[model samples]
Target: MGRIAAGDGESYARSISTSSNVEIRRRTRVTDIAQRVAKLMWQWAAHIVRRKDGRWGPKVLEWQPRTGKRSVGRPPKRWTDDIKRVAGIR
Candidate 1:
């Protein structure tokens, strides 16, 4: 009778061990999939933002006078000498 009880206990222990291993493998696979999805989302968002922003094309500006003869308008989009000077670039 004692030997039979010991065999039952060993079988229960083995079952628990196998179940734990299966659970661990399932969790690892889920984590790997989530990481892959996150990386793809980041890349897609960056691409969309870049497309919305204007590319490296030339821009034309029209100058006009503001109140009290003050010359004010949207500056030229092209990088100019003044911009380089202020930027401390030679």
Candidate 2:
């Protein structure tokens, strides 16, 4: 930018460099943000798979040494719910 502003025939170079964001979307071209978004959504769905111990974590029942105790109350929003909301799943 400095070099372009200081000399003639350099403004073109500066403008081209600055306008690249609009000309090319890096997320869609390189990494493909849509794919990453889907992967994340599936991970969220996996989070809702219940276990026999009344937990939202591991699928295996009593597979770990962690306590499976529950409180006498309602539960919070499930990941599956959010996943459905975002992906528009009924």
Candidate 3:
């Protein structure tokens, strides 16, 4: 650990990160990037939903800007919208 820290920090950091990723992949048995991202997003959404404490993240998700007006032909996609699209309504 000391040798790694004393050597090239960037390379060491990358190796550690890569090793953790491999461990996660082996544990979950999922390798594809798309699936991993989707799975992680779902997990994050579920976590935010289950939180009892009042937090800005969940509040922001539920908040609707009252004064905002559309300037373009189509509205931008939101994080929740993508999640719903991928997983379907519950």
Task: List the RMSD of every prediction in angstroms.
Answer: 16.2, 8.8, 9.2
Cα deviation at 72, candidate 1, in Å, is: 50
Report the error of model 1 at residue 15, Å: 9.0
Off-target runs (Cα >4 Å) in candidate 1 are: 1-31, 53-90
lDDT tens readout by residue for model 1, 1-90: 234475589886776577764486685655566566756755654555456355532221122224465356964443244334644767
Lowest summed lDDT over 10 consecutive residues: which window, candidate 3?
A: 1-10
Q: Which stretches of candidate 3 lie over 4 Å from their true place?
A: 1-30, 65-68
Q: Per-residue lDDT for 1-90 in model 3, tens only?
A: 356556698986786677876686876788879887988998988898888698787896776646677776877767888877877865
Model 2: lDDT of residue 56: 38
Write down the TM-score of every candidate.
0.26, 0.32, 0.57
Clashing residue pairs in all predictions, respectively, total: 0, 0, 0
Top model by TM-score, which number?
A: 3
List the lowest-lDDT window of 10 residues for candidate 1.
Answer: 56-65
Q: Is candidate 1 or candidate 2 better by TM-score?
A: 2
